[model samples]
Target: MSTSGRSRAAGPDETPAIGRPRDANRDVAILDATLLLLTEVGYDQLSMESIAARAGVAKTTIYRRYRDKVALVAAAVEYRSQSSPPAVGPGGLRGNLLTLVQWLAEQIAEQEIGLLGALFAGMRSDPGLAAEMRRILRRDEAAMTDQPLREAVKRGERLAPHAAELFAEVAPAVIVHRIVVAGETCDERFVEHLVDDILLPLLRGHPNKPARTERGTGSKGTRS
Candidate 1:
């Protein structure tokens, strides 16, 4: 009448062996709270105590998920960049790239002054945070860049030899110029100039794809 191998109740100490289900809600809460704090005070100012208070979780929870402030900040940036759309489409390659670049610009502009100041300050104070920032930028941004290049090339449009790297720096350049030098914000016209005046012309001259095919429909760069 007794169950030999089939136990209905799991032992308390055996939970680890069974591996209790991870709470998706808790993970999301932690990530959301981290991003909120990053946007509010940035990498330099965020702390475990503040994050726990903001997330309404305990310090142990924060520590369990992340090692320190650097890990937390990295997670936050990773979450935001991941959540954002890689591209907005239906307009074809040019339109898609344009839309995506505009989106990138807006995202950067949203955190313009605060981001610059905080990370710059953090680099001087915390080496781990500095390294984390670099990793997040490199890894997360490369995600969107690779696909855009392929789509552009497939449409008979030439992708610049270093399109990904070039595009990565473009949005931030305008932000730096505006917030640091010109003391202003970038508008749609500026983004258009970067895409039309700069990025497009260079790609056309590349050996793979060459031509000024407006809107990227009729040209069909060899169709991958």
Candidate 2:
């Protein structure tokens, strides 16, 4: 449906509504209108007036659920994202992180460049939008420890002192940097390099060197 600016996705069957049940079909119609407008007009050009006209719902109906532009945009982003909790399992740090990164890659490749791209800029003027973006990023960052910590505690890995800061900051930071700053694509190989070369060493209390081979080298089993 929409992810507003967050990297979540909603299937066409989902609604952008919450807090109470709504006229199911009506909400879906409004969201369909929202997504269509987002794709066609971009976020800056999107307006409540356009949503009303597109949905055949009065502006009052739209306003009744969403108090302002920020709320409506957030709902649409969450809707399209089908925002679900991070996958949790005994796979520990590595497993949890892989799912998290894969989701980020997909969202950037699929949603951010299309219907939701403009939401990124909207954050400049809207604090709520900025918070949503941070919330989405933090979920992945915080997930690194759930199982890993449990396992480390069992084996008495001591949880290394700097580990907390590293997990919560570095992995997400690189991905964010690559996407938001360097404009690099987060392909599967890159994620693998990050995990094998970057994350594993940090977890083990080693330097943050992720092993790598250049573009033309033969594939090796080493990290990167």
Among these predicted structures, which one has the highest TM-score? Answer: 2
lDDT of 1 by residue, 36-80 (tens): 776678666788888888878889866766666776665555544
Per-residue lDDT of model 2, residues 41-85, tens digit only: 776788999999999999987777677666677666666665443
Estimate candidate 1's RMSD in Å.
11.3
Residue 97 displacement (Å), model 2? 3.0
| Pairs of residues clashing in candidate 1 | 155-221, 156-221
lDDT of 2 at 79: 61
Clashes of 2: 12
Worst 10 residues of 2 by lDDT: 1-10
